[model samples]
Target: MKVSTHTCPVCGFDQLKEAPRSKSGSASFEICPACGFQFGVSDDDDGLTYDEWREDWITRGMEWSSRGIKTPRGWKPEALLKSVLKKKK
Candidate 1:
């Protein structure tokens, strides 16, 4: 949900709203009011074109969804973060 009103490259439409993200923490869809173009946020984060942004989004998504589903990818990232954040008792 952390998004700015940026122009959609696909539709040359500047008006965009932050659509709800999926369980994977990726934007489920974007709607262009001018052209009625719809596209997913992942379509914008490919490594070849936007590697830095992709990494940034991934980090944010992981953090935001930490309390939600434990993605099928694995629990290592969440576990690692929890361990790192855990206080010594």
Candidate 2:
């Protein structure tokens, strides 16, 4: 009965086919196509918490971080963040 949430915890990009982490909270090592956050590498090795990366991403203008992946048409990072925050509360 554990529902897997595929939503990216960093920028609220919800199209992730598989969650970055498993149900037991293990990193999948899959890189997010939106924020380019490689789950285990960025977190375990680089020692970045989600909040820290999120702040840096915002400061960097929230640009689509994935290389060679086209930004989705009409994608709005601000709106994505808003929607995700609303769900969190």
Q: Rate the local accuracy (lDDT) of all candidates.
A: 0.40, 0.84
Give the lowest summed-lDDT range of ten residues in model 2: 2-11
Name the candidate that leads on lDDT.
Answer: 2
Backbone-clash count (model 2): 0
Best by TM-score: 2
Residue 50 in model 2: lDDT: 82
Query: Across residues 1-89, which tens digit of lDDT does each residue of candidate 2 receive?
Result: 96555878888997777778888989889787777888989999999988788888889998898877788999999998887668768
TM-score of every candidate: 0.29, 0.85
Worst 10 residues of 1 by lDDT: 63-72
